[model samples]
Target: MLRKNILLYFLYIVSSIILLFGLGYTKNWENKDIIVGFIFLGCYIFGTKYRFTSIILLVTFSVLSFYFPTGIIYGKPTEAILISLIQTNKLEVIGYLMAIKYEIFLSVLFIIIQFLIYQITKKEKNKFKYFTIFAFIFLYIVSLFGISVNHHGINRNAFLKNSIDSWKVIRKQKEEQRINLGDSSAIKIDGKIDNNDDTEIRVVIIGESVRRDYMSVYGYPNNTTPFLNSAKGIFIDGLVSAGPNTQLSLTRTLFKAIPTENKIHWGINVVSLANKAGYETYWISNQGANGWGDDVFYNLSKLATQNKFLKAGDFNSGNNDDEEMLPILEKIINSNAKEKVIFMHMIGSHEPVCSRIGNFTPNFKLHNEAGCYAATIEKLDLFIEKITKILKGKKYKLMYFSDHGLSVEKTEVFHNNNIVEEYEVPLFYLDSDIKEQIHIKKKISGLNLLDIFSSFINIKSNVTDSNYNFHQASKITDNSDPIIYWDEYRPFSTIQKKQPPIKDIQSNIIGDTVKLENNYKFSKECVSYVDSVDVAFPLNKEVYKIYGWAAADKDKKPLDEAIGVFIMKNNQIYFIQGDKQARNGVRDHFNISPGERDDYGIVSFVDKKYVDSIKNTYLGYKDQYNQYHICIRNNQF
Candidate 1:
């Protein structure tokens, strides 16, 4: 019996070590992770009483810890996971279970092993049970203090506790605020609301998780927003959100929160203010009715004369797409309300990007998350067309803006507050009468939305500051004020300090031109490549044109072989490659000429008259692996 017990104990220790180390390897094996795994194994083997209850708890903990790293990689932290579990219905839970079927299988295998150990040790008595209990208590205390060996920011115990605490605080605050909205006098607007035109109808379309950089209307390579691009609207460039997340951003955007203010007065939101001003305010949302501080949104919507939450239930109810709100929106537009302010909240481009499209075919063929995201945007463009067509020929003006943007880095699409892309959203004003398009290049914050709305409705508010109103006479651009964002809600500079400053090419142009000598030294790289290169020169200023190109060598096939363009100006050599090779479209600023050997092409600069002259200029050279060519001619090649 003693020998059998010893064998069982050995098997348990071996199994524990294997499980712990396997989990560590999933997160990329660092020395720290291996050490952490060994420590965890020691704790599991020595710190637990050999009873069925203790064994079950230890087994569950081990399985969860093993899967935790994988969960975090997919942006599902403990907090998010708990929130999802709470908000999801049985059907949604089933769907999630289906998605992670393999994980469940692995968990079951671990559970079976744990059950065997528990069964085998049921009759055995643990002599050192007191010491085991004390060790467990010590481990718990250490874990609570966030002392762990793994260094990839995956602190299991502390992470779980923090997530629980954060969610609890958020929920409590939202609930308390919702309860306080019963008093009408709690929210008061000290302003005179005057509407010069009674027939005018204004619409505020609130988009969700949409990045401006992804939209073709905002100069993206893909035509994701064809309708918005052609539509006569005033596109405001560089409009960043106050927060990367919806709850934080929308709270600031809809309320008159000053730049210095931390708290958001829920009762004093745009809907409440519009209600106070005697406008028939309507809130139409396609997002879920509850979860993720959405109860606060519901409470705020109570201020509106008519409100409809199409996608009712918690976060797991799934998004119904932006078009789902269109039918109700049409009904509201055709209603008897004369001077109305309808707020349409859309579930635009929220992640899992593929689910946003529903059954609709994607517009682009990128065939990834980006393609799905682009497809969703295209669907939104179509939805915009539908809304605009319904309100055509009326004295209606529509203002569209996203609550916050999403961060897409490589294959990962997430909400990262640290990155600027997560806050950069598109804001545009589409008026029925305005035919010509207007583009505003100034940087603005979504926090100034209340003031912009006030200006739109022609309301003079004593409580609201209109210093940043683009429509009013007191329009000002204030870059000195910091743009506050993130979960902690910290402030960051409005100007992108990391990016290189764009030097004005016109300002740097010298009056006297330096002519190039005909003594050119061509590198004998390749023997058989020729292409027509186009170069343009300024008619007023004489500038030297340098052209360089290289094609792949058939014989040598060297990897280091490359083609580059070198321009010598003001005793400084500047090299430029194609726009595709440049980072953030900053090719013109490099000191050394950049090159591209793949599509060995031409690079030149010219004025309007000289553009035509350099269109057909041809010059040839050779390099190590590719044939090179230089051209200096014009005429719109």
Candidate 2:
């Protein structure tokens, strides 16, 4: 009896560890699963026979897992996360808390279920009870075996440490660094441009959370790209996103693959290069500071003669519209600056499309995969139309495509994995002055998106320092560079290029004259070193002053714009005038990270009074006892 009890306790402990580690794999129910799994195994071992305990724990775990993942990764703490949580059903800060709360509720439910199980097995005695215990052990062992087999490096022990899990801990660490840096380190202006006579304004509309293939521009049945349909731009017809997420996709889109055994951070991207070429580079964005690598974008913007950073939540009050560009574009066009290159990063076709539509609901309201995605596309079409009209009279070139495509319809748990549609995007380029300048008339994949930059500036560039590169069958069809792709676990690579069998089609679209002979095929390869350290903008003193914190000129005039504050205290308002030095009455915000400042973020003057008032009010809630933040608009905090 003593030996049996010892064995049972050992098994229970092992099972609990397994349960805890397993929860990390899922974005939901991580904590509660650990507790319930512990309780259930313990009760069963001791013959407690209380089903209610396990049931309640299970429910509570599930609920908490959902909401705990809602905090913004960077910038000052705006009610943005909190308010968004309250208003949205998609995902929010409160949603995570609620998930935790409900996990507790589930634990209670599990206890009830256990009682039922006990009542059913009441007639059984020694033999039956031993059989049941063995069965539970068998199930746990099987699960542990499968998980360990698939992810060999992962185990119950490693999951317990906050710093061990690469996805959870490493991702958080990177975010912390980004928050402190305050996102102004991405800029790189090497030299001055003597000649600026291009006269044609080129606008690259960087979209967020937009999936290609779903857009009407990509020949979908729905009219998602209605704005681009009537507008003057070449829809490349054969463009696909490099990755599903912004970081990977942007890296793939901007950098070209190089042949090196070790990974090296090749400093300065195409954006920085553009700034060096003398074109006025302006980054007008509608996303948060840390979305993608806004630090990169923020730094790149400063390199340009003119730059603007606009927070999405402020202007739309949560809506994302193409109309938002009207005023900004007008301002640029009205300026006497001879040549311009505007990079407009839109909150295009992101999830919660309903927030983007404002009070106007979609004609079709089916929440199914096809219906919801189709509605989002249509909403984009409306905004595109509005933006096109603004570009009419200016000698401008417009190119619009998504960073990555999404899989909204997948019913499977890991639907985003191995789906071609997730990476395929409709690529198009519209030119007002040089319609005949387009060289490739065939299906040129978006693998070499950065190559377009070379064409834009009339400069021939190899620009190959990334995993993906531009490849045209007629030009360079070499598949020597390893292709890096991502799954749920980690990034994988492939060496060979296998073009998909192509089909013949015809259309009157601008770039439709070029026929695509083959389709782009997905392959995985192996690369030597996955880790790299490139030159990063750490937002050192020079960058801060350029964006209006320290001093741009000797006179100490703040170069950037307004200052914002987020109060941790309840019912209190925090305010700072200009993005300059700390005044007598105002507080001096310090950097939380080594290379940047996160306590204060960038905000516009429009939000000053409201944010200040709220922070002042925050003082009343001393019990909240959390870190609050301040954001300086249009500049790094």
Candidate 3:
């Protein structure tokens, strides 16, 4: 049989796998399925005259998997692919297709391989006919194993049926929402407003990924916000977003979060009420208008009088600067509209913080990733300064608040860890009317944002309590406001909270200078010195996080961005860019000082085989004052 046509067989399998995972990445294939789906595929294989049907199905699904995996890793198609496809522009679809050109080419190869297999196997007794059955069984088991272990997994032949099922579910949801919206009348506001001043300017800024814990104005040691610190404003001590992510926070904040039938109701929002209240509403954004949770902004922005977006999509690409929206805002300010309620959205520190800083030498600087993060905040500050300067001599009340906060360990940021920090956002109001700054020391849950925002914008509604309270937002205030984390409203009393370190409040020591020292081992009791070191085995990503602090250093004097973390495996040395983290208490042993110790991390992810193979490994970093430190964990050695 000429080596059983091995080349053709290999090509066919490779092409099929490519198409399977490729389509998964694009979200064209369903990622979860039932065993009946496999039986259906087998039926399709047996019933179809084209024996190559299985190969075609596999190839098509692989392509879908690949496409959707890209989305999963990058966080896209959040609502659903069908919804995205219905609303998305054709250019994006073409761009996605272009992105998977390799997969498409491999799919074409499946056709060629199928032709060759049919030509060669047509006249034979088909001795290898069970190959398809064996392959199907192997894939089914593998997919089942994956599902048992991980939350996201797709079985064999889940490609077509499950996708159609997902499509139908999404379709039903859309149709239901449409009907619900059509049947339900929008909540109306019929009353007089206090927005009589013709020249009053109200500016609201929505910050991205800026946690209040990281702000100097909010008692952070780093002084990340210089402008807000100096500005006389109403500093909200306890202000939290409705949800952790951009979509959840904004949707619930902008609209009434009255859920009906597992679907968010879009009835009577701040923007709609503002429009109804005869205020000239403007939504100016320096962030991408649509992507991830951006559709929330896009939908509400449509309700504004005039809207301008920096980009259509391409979120977190970091091409947009908050300062860019200033000019358009100034234009809106110069307009003849008497009472203007302007919503300015800032990309005030989304992930990959370095990109947001670009080439500008940040006035507020720190070491490595911290500086990048701070620089983005500073950029936003500068934007605020410029806008305030432009609005000088005018009656303006500018309010700024972050959508949610990010958790920083060393240098790397966990976008959302369900930590309390994710909901802790700074809500500051700079009113030129008040001569002194006011601090509201009560944490506010944005679940009541609709009424509060209406009050802030002077959207008087008979439906809501028109009597405005300066301290507790509106009448819909909570005595003990709870935040929504992982879709559950949690009280602060329930959460295990870590107070800011004494050093964090007492010290503001951040330096920029490279300091190198040889690697030094610490005793088991790492803090205040010597104890016996313990040894273990199989170094991997999960364990690296536990012992990673050993690789990092904590110094008052910080090093510049070009720091490197080196790891030794046997005699071979590997150098990493060193994404530093200040996270303390690896496994309940020591409390790290923020100003004194630079606790950078030496983290790596290796395969299970390599984990056992790595024998003598050393991890270390240099402090600003030229001090060398190495964490000698007994486990890996």
Candidate 4:
């Protein structure tokens, strides 16, 4: 019996080690994870004599351990998971279960093994003293403190606490907003309107998760925004959004909040201001209305003269494209109301990009995922064109801007927490009457959008700051003023210090020198090369050049071999590629070419005339082999 017990104990330890290592390998092995594993292991071993308690504790720990890795791997935070749990329907839950069927099976198997080991050791005497229990509890408390205070590692306990706190704060804010909704005195409009009979029609378009760097009009290599490029408007180049997420960004942008103000009362929004201005306000949105209960934006939409929500369900429900709101928009436009303001909120380029594109054909040649994203952009461009056509003869001014931007890192695109790219969105103003195409050079914040709107319709509002109004002022009052971005996890009331300018590989150029390095490994089974050089072809004029190469041993390579030149001239990006075969594919989708290349035996060069057009350029390259190499030289070519 003693020998049998010894064998069982050995198996249990071995199994535990195997499980820990397996999980560590699957998830990235972190020191914090190791510490957590040991803590759990000690509890399991000490509690083995108490069979039932041991089984329960081990099972719970195992489940949590599995979920921790899963959540981290998928980039799902505790708050997001909680939201999904509360909001997801039974069918959706079942679908999720089906998707993780293998993981569920593994978890069950692990639990059973632990149970059997505990059952086998049940007859043994309760060797562990009360001190073992005390020690376990003490260590667990210490671990919790370490997790909460350190903040460097992935701590599930800390994450759950933060998530719970965030939810509580949201609930409190929602309650406050609900109370504010009833307070008529909370919203004050100190604006005078010149009641002109010309019927000024103004449309504020709110785009979703659209990065400025991805649009062709903003100088993206692909012609994803042909219609926008041709449209006559004021293109504000450096308008950073207030936040990375939609809810946070829109709340701040649409409301009248000063830089130093902390508490923002709901109901006093753009819609309320427009309503007070005697303009027939319309709120047309393709985003779901029922998902967010008592959300400030949803409640504020109630203030509109006419409000229409095309999508009734949450994100799990069907996605109705932005184009679906067009018919409703036409109805609103045809209404006989004088001096109107329409807020057209679009479901533009949301994640799961393929679903957003629906049946639209892709206009850019890329990998399947990237192609889907590009297709959505093209679809949005077309939607804008259609709207412009409808308002052709009317006296209207349309302002288009995204609520927030997304980030594309290492070819995987998603919403980043506090990256500059996540807040950098496109802002353009197109008017039937104003023909001059102007570009604002200074950095601006979306927080001042309310002022810009007031200036657009010539409404005299106390909130209107002439210095911040793009339509009224050509330049910013203070060019050095910092554009603030909020930390993702913090409360909306807390103010984060202004982030310093993000130094991209291309933007960090010094004089006639171009030097950058990109060590992004695409895959393990490929050979890749990246090289860049700065040249003064005309001796006095400077130009930059870059080259990329990739080759796989097998025919089915993960990435294609490509070479391109990226030019930043006058705050616009110009991309020129080298290979004609590659250009053919690109042109098929974008309808633009990189210009003819001067083909060398093993290397290719872009046309000198095109190169001469760009005064500055930067280059970087990465391939499927997970290899990123970059080099920059000053007047060496």
The worst-scoring run of ten residues by lDDT in candidate 3 lies at 529-538
Q: lDDT tens digits, residues 1-637, model 4?
A: 7887687776566544434532433234556566655654565566565665566556655554454323422332344444333433332333344334323433444555666776676766676677877766654443333344465643454334445665776667668777775344554455544445364688889988788777778777777888987788888887777766666677668876555655554655677777767788899877666545214556778878888887665544655767888888887788785878999988787764556766566544333334555666788889889998888789888888888766552122455543666677888888886677777765677777777777665566555664455564565653344444453333222333333222131221222222223433234353333333433122212333344333332432313444344455545444444331121211111212214221210122443444533235433333457344322422211
Higher-ranked by lDDT: 1 or 3: 1
- Runs of candidate 2 exceeding 4 Å displacement: 1-157, 160-199, 230-232, 254-266, 290-302, 312-320, 359-369, 410-415, 434-447, 461-484, 487-637
Root mean square deviation (Cα) for candidate 3: 13.1
**lDDT (10s digit) by residue, model 3, range 444-474:** 7766566667667765675455543443443
Candidate 2 lowest-lDDT run of ten: 505-514
Which regions of candidate 3 are displaced past 4 Å?
A: 1-185, 192-199, 289-296, 312-318, 364-366, 462-637
What TM-scores do the predictions have? Answer: 0.61, 0.50, 0.59, 0.63
The C-alpha local distance difference test score for the whole of candidate 3 amounts to 0.53
Q: Looking at model 2, how many pairs of residues clash?
A: 96
